[model samples]
Target: MTREPRSGCPIASTLDIVGDRWTLVILRDLLNGKSRFSQFLSSPERITTNILTDRLVAMESAGLVTKSPYQARPQRFEYKLTRRGEALLPILQEMCLWANAHIPGTWTPPVSFMARKPE
Candidate 1:
């Protein structure tokens, strides 16, 4: 399903880039220091490999991440958040705070994570 871009609304434009459920989860994992594909697979939600690949590509294309090859034999890579992606950390924290307040049984984010300043 394709829709015309809404250039006027900042929120809508941002959502158009990172609206998928997995994108934010992937970003959250990156913020937690998970860099490898296997590490992302270890996330509790157990995202499928295919979706992860697609999202990573989309994110890279959007300048949110950059993947550096870590192993030559299999071309293994580690993904890191770009400055733009790192800027979303506070937004994610706000979401976490909102969830903790409204959702029963929601796990509280670590104090260290909430307290740390973005690089």
Candidate 2:
């Protein structure tokens, strides 16, 4: 089944693909090089297994993430961001900077995080 576009605006069009909360969180982890399922699970945000599984599948279907098998016996999957997904880093950085400046008591991420070039 195909999903309809949320809006005609470019920003909205992009958000239609990655606006969900879990999707961004998943993307954030992937940006940090957290490729393994268990590593995503162990994040400070503590995502549930079922939700994580569903989000990963959705992202894969959306062409934002690609899943690859690392082991054959039990079949493990690792998630990595596609170029489209990696393109969100600048947006994420802007949001983080805005939150840090405008929101009270928001912990700041490292300067390196804000300055790091996308791969």
Would you estimate the TM-scores of all the predictions?
Answer: 0.93, 0.89
- After superposition of all CA atoms, the RMSD between model 1 and the true structure is 2.3
Q: Candidate 2 on 1-119: residue-level lDDT in tens?
A: 34888778988877777777788888878887799999999998899999999888888888888989999989998878888778888888888899999999987977877887777
What candidate 2 gets wrong by more than 4 Å, as runs, is: none
Error of 2 at 41 (Å): 1.0
Clashes per candidate (backbone, < 3 Å)? 0, 0
The residue pairs found clashing in candidate 2 are: none
The digit string of per-residue lDDT tens for model 1 on 22-111 reads 999999999998999999999999999999999999899888999999999989999999999999999999999999999999999988
Assess candidate 2 and give its TM-score to the true structure. Answer: 0.89
List the global CA lDDT of all models: 0.92, 0.84
